[model samples]
Target: MSSTISDPASDGVVRAADGTPLKQRLNRALRREKLRSFLLILPLLAFIVLSFIMPIADMLFRSVENQIVEETIPLTVVALKEWDPASGEAPGEEVFAAFHADFVQAFKDKKHTRLGLRLNYDEPGMSGLFRKTGRPSTKMQPPYKEAFIKVDEDWGTVETWAVIKQASPAYTDGYFLNAVDAHRTAKGIEMVPENERIYLFLFGRTMFLSIVITMSCLLLGYPIAFLLASLPLRSSNMLMILVLLPFWTSLLVRTSAWKVLLQQQGVVNDFLVWIGLVNDADRLIMINNQFGTIVAMTHILLPFMILPLFSVMKTISPNYVRAAKSLGANDWTAFWKVYFPQSIPGIGAGAILVFILSIGYYITPELVGGTSGIFISNRIAYHISTSLNWGLAAALGTILLALVMLLFYVYDKIVGIDNVKLG
Candidate 1:
């Protein structure tokens, strides 16, 4: 029997007396491992860029993008460049000729309506004026300022010229300004009329609701998490199922259930009536209001709080509390000093998660939230799909995203992100 002895370095790896080849091989191995790790994570990295980063970048870009007037009325854009706003008079004949030339072609190309709508953002009645003037623009001759005035005397005003000049820029801060309940005027940026300002109120309401929902979740989830963590494994597993059962249900289904339960004529009202807490004739207005949104959202997000708290609390040793008590501390004092502080990591994680989720929620608030409970997300959706005001929608979305990021920054500063415990 012929036996072959295997050599450790038989694969032709070279080695120097100083072990330089060994170090080179180790470096190569480390590089190979790093490459493998990068390859493994590449797909996830690409997915995040495409799905999250790209959309946010696009939305932020669109918020400041204003090319409608410049693109649709090229001649007018050029003409307005030299026409000074300080002149305090209507545009001159040369400016009118350039505008009339562009306006006629825009009318012929069926772009007048779009240009009109774009300009109308700066001045509300401009759309009607443009729409009415489209047909008559074809009939106008030279000295077009007089012709334009004949079509609509408002076009003769310096304010109309100012609006056109303001909108002619390819990029603008108007959308962002408008989003915060402010507008650009001849003087400078100023607040919108008090009656017309709703965005600030909407933002306030969204933050208020988000805070209330987060607090509600904390109050309800903390005790349950403590119970789950303190119980035996078998009992904890059973109780955990009860907490997680909501996760298995469809979100829409759960929200609809809340709708049914909270409706004026629904089970909750009937129960109140049966208990003589409320009369049948005076059912509570719970659904389609802020109360319904808060109740439904709190129920939906409670699990998020519970899971984090339970994870942290389960790892906490009972001996800490016992030791505190043996040292002359009461039950409440032991818990407050030893237990609750440890659980704060979980609280920070859960509160931030619930607050972030609640602030951006749409469907739950939409179905239950009548006019009063609607969030800024609802308005963003409205501008995106209904009004076709994409720039305005993007601005609103950017503002909300900024608010979330600001909250995250504040949380990080206060709680320290590294201290937040997920498990």
Candidate 2:
């Protein structure tokens, strides 16, 4: 009779049965497991690449892309290729003639001048140039040797052509420079004037605000988290629900409620006055400032800090502190040296979360701080919605994103983000 035999490589038994070699069968099983794991993770990998990586790449492209210039003045750009800026003489009239034709065509097209104006607005006074180029007088004139010059006398000046020439490139760092309160010149880079230098100041203020808010949340949330973690299960569950109650409310509602409560004529001020704590209600300045922003944001983000800390503290047994005390370490020393070090992961996680969220906060700062209280994001919003400067807006956004990423990198280096466990 034929006996069954195992196919060692395939982990399959033959009709002439015999056992497979252990190593080969184990390798086959491992290969199957690896294949199954890959299949299970394939969808997630595809989702991350398509949704996260691709969109970020596109945003980075937009941040540096200068399509308006490339599309608007193709002819002028071609004509000026041989023209040298250092020559100190005007480019040939052919350059002007090409620009004149382009301008006339753009005016006729109605929307074309807008592209030039938008591109030029980054450099200032380009809008006026577009307006002059679109004038009826320039449009009605017949072609002549000086017809281009007649369109705008300034067009002949080397300075005007130089601006146009410099802007002809497909990509530019102009927006990025401007966002950082700096700009490029013919000579090279230079600092912007103090009066107009808003971004650097705003960036500093945002960082300061984020740091303060993060610290405050840590100080206030740590005790509460400790209490929740140390308590029995039933009590901890009820307290956690209370702590998380803010999460159920909309952020906007919470901020608005603070505004009503903290206003000079609001409940808090009235209570203080009723309790004889303050001399005047007007002294209770709450809305339209940094204090309001910090208070509202701290309240909203406190739960984030608390939850992670509670999880970490819960996993840490009280016996460690007791064991330290038994070994002659004082209560404060034991808690500080033993417990605090272990909770670093939670601290890092909470701080990173709060700092990142604080940097991007718009509505709270806008509503509470008003003009003086606005952060970098408010300026970004204005540039996008009102000024219609996508380049500047994108540049500002890119800078904010970079700062947050840098913070993450630093935190990861210091505390090893890979080791951070939420539970």
| Candidate 1 backbone collisions, by pair | none
Cα displacement (angstroms), candidate 1, residue 98, comes to: 0.7
Task: Tell me the tens digit of each residue's lDDT in model 2 across 1-423.
Answer: 123543444444332223555557778889999999999999999999999988877767877887776676678789989898778877886776676677666777685557656656556766776776676534544443266566667666677667777778889888888888997766678878889999999999998988999999999999998899889999899888888788678988998999999899889888888888886724588778988888888998898789877877888988899999999999899999998998887787788878888999999998898666788999999998998887888889889989889988877885577765442
lDDT of 2 at 71: 73
Error of 2 at 267 (Å): 1.4
RMSD of each: 4.7, 4.2
For residue 209, give model 1's deviation from the true position in Å: 0.7
lDDT of 1 by residue, 196-220 (tens): 9988899999999999999999999
Best candidate per lDDT, number? 1
